[model samples]
Target: MFFSPAQIYPFPGTSLAEDPEDIQKEVLENYAKDLPPIYLDVVQHADLSTLIWAPLMFRYPWNVVFGKLSKQNITVAGDAMHPMTPDLAQGGCSALEDAVILGRHIRTSFVQNGQVLVLKNLSEVLGKYVEEKRWHVTLLIMWSYISGWVQQGGSGRGMKFLRDAIFYKFLFLKMVKYVNYDCGKLDF
Candidate 1:
């Protein structure tokens, strides 16, 4: 059973004590104050002494716009290419999509060149891979961030209405439709 309480500021490494148990208790106490009754009840009874605390960090989609994903023949895929919030549960799926698309591009290039390994061809192959994945990855990042924001933004009445009534009813199906995306076969 895992629970993630959103929007907590990361604890500075220097402020952490040597004792992990103490840190765990302090973390739970500090963050558990705002949890709803159901979660608070679980926390109260759970043996959280062995609980592990890891920060969830992600770069906003806009920050990645101007960043270069490829340099010469080298490129990145998966989380390295698009680190997003887990709200959409698409991180690993997108990574696999990256792999299939990248592999398909590489296979096409290799086959066209008579299976010869050319340094210059690699540059184009990686560029194509990056170009193809850029928009898709950016959209995933944006949507995942928005989903996380909507689900955990605030507990106020208006926010609750927006989240529960509008988002869940109307937007959730659209958000999850990305799961139907087909990365296509690897065979050229």
Candidate 2:
């Protein structure tokens, strides 16, 4: 049986002194009572003692992420470019796509001359990568934030009902169709 994990977000932040086991116990207590056997089994088998904690933070005004995609010959990818909430689970997938797309552009542009390294062509090639990725990442950031907002329980009952009944089933599903994209093969 498939058991989708649920998280209650915007939780009070964890401190260095907080024990992972304690946190795990609290989390399980909150949900285990209502979960089915499969979920309880997962909780039982989980080694919460080894779990590492990190802040669940997202960058607001996503333009900041887009704005820094490319500068001179350097460009950011993955979490460096778009630090997003995990609601959509696209963060790592998008990063891997970025690498492939960037590699393709670099191979097609800079390596065409058979030169090992071409400093002059670097900027131009990286610019193309940024151009191709900027809008896509922007869309990802915005949608991820919206998805998180809805899942975390929106402003009120009306908003929650709209998100769950209408937005999630219709608009969000359509948006997700665009996420399963192919960056295509890098022929090099």
Candidate 3:
């Protein structure tokens, strides 16, 4: 499994002395029942005879933000103003859309006076960008989180069936149209 806590867990090149063979065996024995079973023949097990355990272990955290970056100062872009989940993969696309709209607004403001104007002159444009795109990004993040929660829920069976049958097939597909967008020709 992948490392759960970056700081708390041992990483690559860490000494195996920390958790000796007995501890490792006990830990694996406890968790093996919780994990999905796998076949060793799925991959080349030629090296299995030489190694102590499996090489790859994926440990994904629940609802992790991972890292955050300051997205906006005076003028950066959309993601700077909003921080959300990577659920729908709109983090960058929405940023691109924001950049396009903001750039056009700045271009129009500059072109009107033949010179770059003050920050005060651009506040209205910036406000409009934030006002217009905030709700869209918020919805994207909310839905992404909800979907993830459902999929990774506690050994779900009935819920998963309902989600796959009703939401994923009937509802979620249409909601995805918000992310596959291009703002270039818009008159916003």
Candidate 4:
């Protein structure tokens, strides 16, 4: 089974902390106290002067799921296949890439397995899927790690500077590789 929560957002850091007075200062700065009843209701539940802090955690189950659909056995894209830090926003994009790659691999697998696939050929099909997906998926996975590290201030100053100076530009080029996606156009 696969699960994707709707509440996940980009992690600014592992956590945010503020003293009671500072918390009030921020709340006032954000103007949440005047927004509406729906917003103010959350404040009504507790003292506005309390020390409020929210901690962020990146949790990835990284589980694999597969099923056969009319001779097409495959998995759903997303945290089900590869769960990455939300800092990159690529978790979903990575899933899309997985679905594309998997579809391509399955089609090729069927062609190689002949009209009737046997138990022995199952390994061959799955193996090919892994082989084909490894490098491309790995590139995205590494990017996810780098993006998260930089976003959370975990990266060193030099790395952060480099990202600001060069990697940001590099990202646009990378987008081309991702956007020109077509399982059918791929050259095996």
The TM-score that candidate 3 achieves is 0.54
- lDDT leaderboard ranking: 1, 2, 4, 3
Sequence-dependent TM-score of model 4:
0.49
Instruction: Pull out the clashing pairs in model 4.
Output: none
For 1-188, candidate 2 gives per-residue lDDT tens digits of 11113322463342432687766676577658688889888876788677654656656635644366677788888887777778788889989999999989888875686846687888888888887887777777767866776666535788778787987788788778878878899885
Give per-residue CA lDDT, model 4, range 69-131, as digits (tens): 113344335554455555556666666666666657656666676745565556556566655
TM-score of each: 0.73, 0.75, 0.54, 0.49
Model 2 scores a C-alpha lDDT of 0.72
For model 1, the superposed segments whose C-alpha errors exceed 4 Å read 1-19, 22-52
Q: What total of clashing residue pairs does each candidate reach?
A: 0, 0, 6, 0
Model 1: clashing residue pairs?
none
Worst 10 residues of 2 by lDDT: 1-10
Provide the overall lDDT of each model, using Cα atoms, as 2-decimal numbers: 0.75, 0.72, 0.52, 0.53
- True-vs-predicted CA distance for residue 30, candidate 1, Å: 11
lDDT of 4 at 188: 44
* Candidate number of the best lDDT: 1
Scanning candidate 3 in windows of ten residues, the lowest lDDT window is 61-70
RMSD of candidate 2 to the truth, in angstroms, is 6.3
- Report the C-alpha lDDT of model 1 over 34-115, residue by residue, as the tens digit: 8898887776666656655566565666545777889899998888888887878998998988889989998988888898
